[model samples]
Target: MSLIYVLDILGTFAFAISGALVASDKKFDLFGVLIIAFVTAVGGGMLRDVLINAHPINWIGDLNYLFVIFTAVVFTFLFKSKIAHLSKTMFLFDTVGISVFTLLGLEKGLSYDLHPIIALIMGMISAVFGGVLRDVLTNKIPLIFQKEIYASACLAGGITYLILNHFHIPENIIFIISASIIIIIRVIAVKFELELPKIKDDLFTKK
Candidate 1:
């Protein structure tokens, strides 16, 4: 498989695991866990496809995606204790997944001749929308809305990918560098508990 394809598969697997982990924490049944895994794995891609008119969607064209998600769910089921205890490890995997997926989304948008701004937005959505849905369904606040450096990291990476591609950098190197930037920023932000400023509830008055 191509490097891009490998990264895509890895990202899907990581996302599936994240979803399964959350579902397990909520005491969801096996079917519910699998549903969360499947949805988290492909939700963003499906949205991107719909918006871009990439009909039939990506998972439809590739059963391997489904296989990967199923495998992730199985792995999570068999090793819930070990995996559940590794919150930092899970975060690391999630960082990698979002970074890689963001680049993939940006590349797809560019390929479709979409504007760069739209491409960047799609990239952010591709990385975080699934997580948002996962959190909402699980009755937790979405990470992106919690002042953490979540979606912003994806946005930074997506924009960096576009800039590098604009300058004609080697595709593989560009992908690696852009993803690294994202992962680094996320790790640093999490490690230091860095958060973006939130709008204070009293900052605005009724007109």
Candidate 2:
């Protein structure tokens, strides 16, 4: 199998596990957990595929994607206690998922002849909206709606991919660099409590 395909599967698995953990934290039943896991794993990709008119949505096109997500849910069930003991397990998997998804989405968009700017937007959406859906389902605000620098990091990585591609960098190297840029930006932002500047509430009130 191609490296890119493998990475995509890994990202799906990570996202599924992240969603399953969140559902478990909310005391959701098995059916609820499965729904969240499937959505988190492939919701963004399915949206992207629809927007691009790609026939057969990602998970539908490849049964392996469904298998991976199912395996992830089972893994979470079997090792819930052990996984919970790890520091920031959900955060770690979520970060990895976004980083990988961002690049893959960008490439897919380009393959469909989308303009670079639009492709970058597609990449950001693919990396972020699954989490947004997950949060909305759980009655929490999405991270991107907060000052949290989530979609911004995906855009940064997408830009990095474009620039590197322009310079004729090796595809493997570009993939590694772009994915690392997303992960690094996310990790540093969270560690330092960094955020996009917000408008003061007083400004609106005064107006």
Could you list the CA RMSD of all candidates, in the order they appear? 2.6, 2.4
Candidate with top lDDT is: 1
How far out, in Å, is residue 181 in model 1?
A: 0.8
Model 1 accuracy (lDDT, Cα): 0.87
Candidate 1, superposed: residue stretches over 4 Å from native: 201-207
Model 1 C-alpha lDDT per residue in residues 1-207, reported as the tens digit of each score: 297788788889889999998899899999999888988889898889999998778899899999999999999989888885877777777788899889888888888899999998888878888888888888888867987798778888888898999899989899999999999998898889899887666648575
Model 2: lDDT of residue 10: 74
Instruction: Estimate the TM-score of every prediction.
Output: 0.91, 0.90
What lDDT does each candidate get? 0.87, 0.87
